[model samples]
Target: MPPTPPSTPARDEARIRDRGDACPGALRLHAADDGGLARLRLPAGRLTAHQVEALAVAAETLGDGRISLTSRGNAELRGLAEECGAELAALLAEAGLLPSPTHERVRNIVASPAAGLDGLGGPEVQLWARELDALLCAEPWAAALSGRFLFVLDDGRADVAGLGGDVTLVAVRPGAGQEPAARQESAAGQDPTAGRLHVGGRAWLVAGADAPRAALAAAGAFLDAARAAGNGAWRVRELPEGSTPDVAGALDRAGIAAEPVPPAESLLVHAPPLAPGPLGTASFHVLAPLGRLTAAQLRALLPAEEVRLTPWRGAVVVGAAPGHQDHARLAALDSHGLITRPDSPWAGVSACTGRPGCAKSRADVRADAAPGSARGLPVHYSGCERRCGHPHGTWVDVVATADGAYLVDGAPTPRTALPDAVTTARTGAIARAATPSTPAETTR
Candidate 1:
């Protein structure tokens, strides 16, 4: 059986300060071992169709013509030649992508993918997401946050909210008794928007006027305290003891109402939205075998549709043709190992770029963990022992130990005896080793 999930520790109060976050942007790409890397932050994981075309164009014209989806719901372009940096930056800026030079990298925000499209008559979670993004963009202090820091705006459904974001805004469904008060002062005359706001597992019931604004203010408070502390922490949960104020206190400073809801039965799972029905279009998800894309593939992608970069180390190609992806198109994608349906062995498998891509990698794990070649739940490929992009919630963990590769969930099983460790991890069954001669695992 899988190990019992680890319990979340209480928030620490220790203050942390940082020189600044080193997150990269399209304008300012980072030179990695493999090549130049650029990260494009996707606030709320939402994009317009035109912007999608621009990204494909940018990837082809500037970098290696391949696009990568990051674990932060952002996009990356890799293997760029040094000569193209300035031209690439200028092209991205012209596309309305690189907004603020100083603030480009720190604009890390994630919102539920189903926010606006969900028809639960819920509050406009998308509205709150956009409003918060605007607030972050306008604030100078927010730039102090590390590139890894994250903000999640979840519609009470808790989808992206469960991904362990530093800041979260969850919607509350109001009771019938409050309907009269809700309508008279509601932002969009909606019932879903009528409930209290919660932060850091604490609740705040604000007057309708202060609800949204206070949430932004609350984020500011967290940032302020984090900067005051000396530690170089990126998230609120990482603050030193007594550094982070209680959620109620933060709201008190912001003048927002406070309340507490009963504990939830299950954390939200971000399964891709099912294909759209006859009347409307539905968003869809797709995975990049190694978060690497070719220039030709970029050009071939439909430019009119916006794409979502998932924190799951995959990209969701939204606005797929309704009913189902065209059969021939599906075949073409399959030829490239980009599976659209759920049953494909590639469904739950994800790996990071090892070997030539990352200096700390122990092996070229991607080449060994090719899609369909392996099978398993939440399988992750790591260069060294540090598992960087492993899924946060629940899934099997495959790590590269000094002795050999190991499967981590409860116990660590050495790869020396397994027939094919890679295939076993991917498919969830034991098999013979596919290749001989194991790569030596090293630690720094």
Candidate 2:
């Protein structure tokens, strides 16, 4: 009813690519409307307070005094000087952020931020995140992957399963635990590491596919598919049906057994979105009004050892205790304007940079996208039709069409009707969010 939870559906064929992936990296910068931009990859978005502080200092001293969170769970430093690559590189290198130069861009990985801390999702996926990352960086051939290539390690909670990943591995469990009704028939067995594998258009029931093996096999499968396609396919979803990697064969070749999931019973995989606020009493998840965070906001997270940046423009602040977060420290974050409670409307808002930051933008979306007014669903304000950072699942899409008039998910609406439409959409999404059958639906 509420845009029935998504499945791992076959996507439309992608066009061939002739050039390199222009995605920015810590050393390689992109010239944007504002200035040079550098992206730092954080596998699973795991970062220590020291690492976070290092990034904050670099942003304040070398860039625009701001650090932006990305949908890939990465970090970006913009407004950089033309010749600051050397300084930026040196700083990041010392902080151990750049593990490998050749594979930095290809290190696009996202996992459940609350994997273990939330105590609901299966398998502590951050463990797999590191092992897989190490394997990727060590394999020279992996460097050939396009910067846009992505891998998802969902913790069976569905938080990041539907970010349209090139390769996805999700934990399998039974009973009702945040899964949509559509998923009941296809729910796999209870295996912390073993789960269904989605590589491009095909699905496989993998055996012995732990994080390390699954990650390696997925990468190998893509390489085989890409080579067979020979059309510059950068992602598994890009290859035609003929070129869809024989994931089963790849796993077998890797000594990882995998059987074809019956097409009818393959996992439905509903990826619900994670709400911003304290997450399940184990940790405090907070978000900025917008995706961008100034150095001061980042500093506010300090004295806290580790943090995980989510694709949804927020973070999970874990506690030193066995299964709880430090309330006082979380309160400090709340003081700094982070949305630590679900009731705060800032939890439901996001906007892409417009105006001075993006030349193609027709409107300054960030200027108009204010938060703190509670909404049931997420609202994304886009400068143009591209909708660069909209929610992955159901949401209220506010796209700019003119000075005041706009489109709500493509239908034209008067400026006056915008709020009502958004409210209606949010109401539906809120109902879905509260439904026990829903799953997490964060973006890529």
* Candidate with maximal lDDT: 2
Best by TM-score: 2
lDDT of 1 by residue, 90-122 (tens): 776777677777777767777655454445325
Please list the C-alpha lDDT of all candidates, in the order they appear.
0.57, 0.71
Against the hidden true structure, what lDDT does model 1 obtain? Answer: 0.57
Q: Tens-digit lDDT track for model 2 on 1-444?
A: 433222332435555667766767888888878999888899998888889889999999999998888777888888999999999988998888999999998889899888876677754567778888999999998898987788888887777888777788776554444333334233333443455677655666553245467667778878877887777777776676677676667667777655566566555476556776565555667886688888999877665548888898887766532344466666777888787777776776887666678776777778766442375667787777556656666666677776666666556766667667666666653443311110111112
Question: 160, model 2: CA deviation in Å?
Answer: 1.3
